[model samples]
Target chain A: MSPQQPDANPSEKLSRYEPEVREAYARYRETGDVDAVQIVIIAMVREHLPKPSDAPITDEQKLVEDLGYDSLAVAEVVFAIEDTFGLRIETSEIMQISTVGSLKEFIAKKLGPKNE
Target chain B: MSEARVMPTDKKGRRRVVISGAGFITPIGNDWAGVASSLREGRHGFERVEFFGNPNVPVKVAGTVKDFVVESMNWRDWKWPARYEIARETLRGLAPHGVYAICAIDQAAEHAGLARGALANDDATGLYCASAGSAMMLHGHLGQMDRTRGERGNPMGVVSSISGTLNFNLAAHYKITGSVCGFVSACASGSHALGYACDDIRLGRLNRAVVVAGEELNAETLLPFAAMRALSPQSDPNVASRPFDTARDGFVGAGGAVALILEDAETAAARGARALAEIAGWGQAADGHSVAMSHPEGRGLANAMKRALSDAGADAGEIDYINAHGTSTPVGDRAEALAIKTVFDTNKKQPRISSTKALTGHPLSLAGAMETAFCVLAMNEGFIPGNPHLVNTDPVCEGLDLPRETLNERPRLVLNNSSGFGGSNVCHVLRAVG
Candidate 1:
């Protein structure tokens, strides 16, 4: 089969990532959650990461401990995330977030489907 | 019984400190006379200009110092060795002395007739400064570096860009051996620097200190603000900044520097130096909100104002004038107005408020000190400067008593407010002293 060819349609293709992506997509489709926190984090990391031609960033990569980001740079990232999501991230929460995966988890907690 | 008057000093018996002299480089005009006249005349300093590739950016007006020539002065007179060549060249004309922060400190020290090492040898003497960022030299160096070169792209970038090092450089230049440091709190930086210096004196940490606020305007930084649509684009190139006006669009970006010679009041009296004004109180607060936006309710700003009054032990009704941080932004102006209402609501006696940004433009880090000069001027002249080009008033700013035009009157107490990008707010209360 060609590289472009896939057995699933676009919707099914998107669902392969994780249930969170599907839920995010559903929220986006319903209320246009363009300002979602996860989306903002993705966008910020995408811009800062080394290009595909350079070293690729893994989801598990530590943003500061491994990537060598100083406090100011991290503050800039946090600012971008807050601006994107229109939500206030407490300073305490910011102190706890050190890795990409941790950030993703934080966003998922805030944005995941409501139990009610 | 005319007994010998005892000299007041710190624990080590150094002289006390107060503000003996002040200098301002602002948008309206450079010297005190010119700035005072312009403010009194209600002159608007904004004008249209082509900032970027965008032509229809709608607004174009800024308080620009068109005639400033920084290239004409001698470099050696500016105390420190020139670390950045471009900065050296920029400082040449404007100052007869050198352009470094130390040069400013030395000049203020010299004007006050103090000895060279007064700030250095006196443990009580310290250096406090507010700067937006280190000069653009670091930025230029970083830009030239090859990212491909990794960490070795530019060695000086790290050293020069550290926010605290600028004061170290100044201390080294002026031979100031006392405690030296710089504060970075965005736009309110200069005020915080002054306030911190005052706190040290009030606490008896230093017998005297030097406070300097320096702002350098470079295309590198202005371009970013222009891109962000944070500045006014008045096309006329003159009269572009209009603060507190209904048609006010945004702030006009400009830069300059100011320095204050703060000494203990008793020491100043002994030296027979004229005490310009009393540094009474300071208040600071964080909005804890968006980095680029202020809280809509202006809660943090109100708290800062209330705290400032409490710090001064003065009632809100006692404030005669206010030097507002009115950048003319839509949200910032409204938020500040709400804050003013909350603070001065009891007697319905609104103090006269005016935006000096109309004259000086927004000097970023240097704004606090530059506005401090205006407060002193207002207190001395007993007149409140007007918000230039303020024809129409916003409905939200309706109840607030803003100075529509220049008003001549003696203001006993003045409150100056400076708010920055990261939700940092600072308020200083200045009082006229005999």
Candidate 2:
């Protein structure tokens, strides 16, 4: 059987870190870095990840399955990201977030002019 | 270094409890053996507080643990990545007291060689601890909220500062399923935990348990004591912790943690675990007197000692050494001294008395457990503790032979005493099974 995907896009109306998302987008456009957001997540995963992968960063890698980050670690990473960007991650957004690529995509949408 | 050796013959039904392993982090030393050596060498570790200073308070020096990093602790069962950065960030919110709690337990578990083979979760494995939760965890979280002007703050960090954090964190770490308790009986908290760990084994309730007690010294915690004039008036670190001396003012605040792994004699022997000193007996009592003052006649502490001796099936004259709950407060020291003299007559060669606090300053809840570990080391290594700042003896301490100088000898039986705030008193009679 095929695995269950998030039936509906949780980010459709998800608005938590409006201010931080806007600020991060402005910073990303200039520097291509999310002003410590990605760094914080990297730190959260690198702490206990058995072997920090050498592969190029991508969006499809599963947090738990590929990176070996536990649920607790994922929560911590999310918390740090929200704190760094000054936003709150809704449960719906959290349910849909399982990969680094997906989190960045979600952040991009959250930071769009219309979303802001 | 290893703990003192002992052998309790297999009993028919009743069980014997032994201190199998210990881990200590104190101002004087990082481990139990090192701390014992420092005591024997008449070295003190107190130094002026570097982080916080108040010109108004006479309490200047504090016994702080030097150069400690949680990354250095040995982790078992839990896998770690080579380029670990995530775990460090995730755990950055935990308090120093909580971190020390984990280190002490991990060290004890490793010292007992529990890492060699993993054991299944069962009711026999238990944890009992005494800790004053992390002030940093609390104040740090609150301060962040105030600084950021944020309405919501880290609630989990606040919970981690609660006293039960150690019980939850360590029990889950070791997979202990039995009775797990984190007690707070002030200074006697460690003794309370140790005594009851002994009880649980003796009653056949648990096969083995670890007892730990720890306190975190911080400027905020020290300020109240200074305000109450409960800390040493002297600004110098050398004479700050003069336990039973006439010049003694009050205790220099020091903080650290100690862990002692206890096992049933049969369980230890079957597991091929060597025994440290045997916990012969433990007696506890409460002084119905004032909360701030121990009994003037030292009746409460003396009663605890008498009961412990009786429980050990030994007499007063049999005890060769006594570890007094000497905090260096004028009244508290006098009360403990009076209690020792009352329990063991000074007419004979009074049991050589010493306060390990003189070296480590009082680690509050960690005092009793750390002292027990020190007693075991002193026995196996034959090192008597001496007061480096013993200039003049108080009137109450005159009759008692407070080993003013370290003796290069071993003691057979020892009594460890601890009295806390709220009128709590406890005594443990330890038999050096050398």
lDDT of 1 by residue, B46-93 (tens): 444454556665535555554444321122233332322323212211
Candidate 2 segments exceeding 4 Å error: A1-26, A29-58, A64-66, A91-96, A114-116, B1-13, B53-57, B69-93, B116-123, B145-150
Residue lDDT tens for model 2, B1-434: 33434444423345778877777777788666677778889888787874454576566788887655432112211222232222342244345665666667666766676762242377787799888776656676677678656644553554457777677666656667877988888888999999988888888899888898888777755666777778887778878889989989988888877888898877777776767778888898888997878898788899999988987878999998898899988989999998888888778768888897887888888889888888887887787787777789888787887877898878889999999987799999988764
Q: Please state the error at residue B332 of candidate 1 in Å.
A: 0.4
Q: What is the clash tally of candidate 2?
A: 8
Using TM-score, give the best candidate's number.
Answer: 2
DockQ of 1: 0.01
- DockQ per candidate, 2 decimals: 0.01, 0.12
Each prediction's RMSD over C-alphas, in Å, is: 17.3, 7.2
Instruction: Note the clash tally of each candidate.
Output: 47, 8
